[model samples]
Target: MARPDEHIHIEWRGGTCRVKWWTGEYLPNGRKRYESKGGFLDEETAMDYGRDQLYEIRHGIHVSNRKGATLMTEWLDDWLAGMDHGHLTERGYRSAVENHIRPYFARKSVADIDVLAYRAFRKHVNGVLGTGSASNVMMVLGMVLDDAVPRLIKTSPVERTKRRGKFTKKKKKERKKDMAPAVVDRLARNAEIFFGFPGYVFMWTMAMTGMRPAELYGLTREYCYPNWPGTDPRPDPDEEERYAEDLERYGLGDDRMPAIRVERQVQYSGGELQFFPPKYESHRTLVVPTFLAEMLDKLLASHTSRWVFPAIQGGSLGAVNFDYRYWRPIADGVAERSGPRVRRPRPAIPAVPTYRGKRLYLLRHGHKAWLDEDGHSKFAVESRMGHEVPGVEGIYSSVTVPMERAIMKSLQARWEKLQQDLRETDS
Candidate 1:
């Protein structure tokens, strides 16, 4: 070892000179670690190489010797296990890593992945997977590499070039615009035929309350209107005084203002369903029109189970069961399936004319559109949609009793108008 200002050690090899420089780090055995470059034609050239390595070491951007041997698969395992993300998210990351990412970069070391290597992986995923899946896979890869910066590699190579910006939008799938409320009603009518009365209730509640599908499935009799003994969304001890004050100003009672508490959703983790908070932890109460409130009260009376929107088979509805058994038959006509038939399909149930091949998630989007169309307060609309208002608006504005009443009135009027339209058609 020598002083930091002195030239690095150089030695004569078989036909050329070799250089080795102290890395200012030590091994567990208390021996100094050295970074080396060999087979240089002369000592000056070798000394230059040694200087660059020392500079990198000094700047805290030095790549370790083992980096060249650190395979992509090895890094993937270490990175995924370091954090405990939600089960669904972990599952998605693993799917992309194993099925798409690992296969291509498995043998390659982390140090070898550069911008060109990233572009190749991006092209491969786009060619093999759908546009959405490709985007997700790329995102996962970029995240992992970005995490490796300055430790396993100097910097992430996943750069979005101008060429990428030009073609990516063209390659990406166009998002479907929000569905019409009338279309949602048509879908509900079809669902009623397939999944009994609860089926009808599920569609309307989703469209009206803007609850996510999982939230609706996890909805319980206690959270829904007219059955909850008391109205206490914020139940902490410290909030009691504020709540009583609200009661004075807003008549905070279950009977006074019918609402649903967006508490939790069912998440499939490990092997069974577990209760998890709503996405973004958007725990808020949603006011429902009086008509819908009465309808829920009637349904909850005969329903013995805890779930508000139980499956047709009499259990809490899961995404898998809902999509194939209940939703597809209603969204896409039962008789019009494309895949090879296995068992005898159920008797033909006609699809909703306007919602053919559309997703149930669209109903939530349409709910937002309806709120905007009605010209409700931004704070109230975002609160109802389970979305946090951004910037100062979220900080200063709050959903008041008047806002909730206005929303309820607007929704009720929409429902009444639709009923009138149906009656006119029948006449």
Candidate 2:
């Protein structure tokens, strides 16, 4: 038996390997002693393990007859690795750990993490990062720690931590300028001039349909038609001829009509474009207005690829890179020519405002605003936007092409009016 503060050595195989168990001074107060265990194949290993066990015993982490020891980094790695192959998407899970979780707590011992430290981390993140971003980071941390609790590690420090108050009640004020008609005109014109007709049409489609940028990029030729040959009655002669002309002009071979499908989205991640699932509530379709149908036919005639919009990089256009260096300057020039200056104003403190440089998502917002202003039913708007309708609307109602076509027509009218206003003001 080993008394507190005394180390007992054990000899194995005629002292070829030595092991030690001890009782050590208690931690925080440094007064009492507690039992600890350590054994090793080598003198160095024994010394290291003994020293660590003694520390744990002193700190009250190693309890009587229980082996409680694992490095925080080691546990984290195992936990993350296990999750990577599980249901979680590898990219998102890795990002959560790499960008948020591991960076803060990787080096600290699991026992050293306390509620106070966690609360402080949350506060720092909220102050330095925006509340929304901080919330997401906290969510990731919470999830990982929750999984860790009662499994690889003891109770997580995050479980006891509460997010700071100010962030809870904050609702971001919508920047009214984003959905302003003038901004759309400028963006639409620039998209047309620099990216070509398909780009222009694509921009408008996003505006009218409220489809996510990824959804717009994901549109295939098959998705343009509401019905396939032999499914619904063929378009009237004039409409058929118009479709034929549009298809031929764009050089899209033979097939003219197919059901519009939204099965995939193009995402630019890791410096390249990759197709992925559409954003939450983004996998949807809307009927094209006659004019838009005509425009789409014309645009498709000019494109050679199967994609509705393809990159010109001499390969299949998988993702539309939003970070293309040329996009901003071209957009700025068009903004200058068409309407009020759209440059993000610098804050007095020179810090980037939360709303600054988020013009890319504005097209979608403008679309929603247009729908809301035109008295489209909330369900219809939610369907087109791919957002889950609330309550009974989601439970019972279904959206059809006629409803969507009507929405498109309304959007087209609004867009034309804005364009007309722009031309008049310029002249």
lDDT (10s digit) by residue, model 2, range 268-369 = 566776667676625554555555666676777886666676544423334445535324533444232333573433211211132245556666777788
Cα-based lDDT at residue 280, candidate 1:
78
Instruction: Provide TM-scores for the models.
Output: 0.88, 0.64
Residue range 106-177, candidate 1, lDDT tens digits: 889998899889988988898998888998999999999998887899889988554553355546454676
Give Cα-based local distance difference scores for all models: 0.80, 0.59
The numbered model that scores best in lDDT is 1
Among these predictions, the greatest TM-score belongs to 1
Model 1: colliding residue pairs: none
Q: How far out, in Å, is residue 253 in model 2? A: 20
Where is the poorest 10-residue window by lDDT in model 2?
346-355
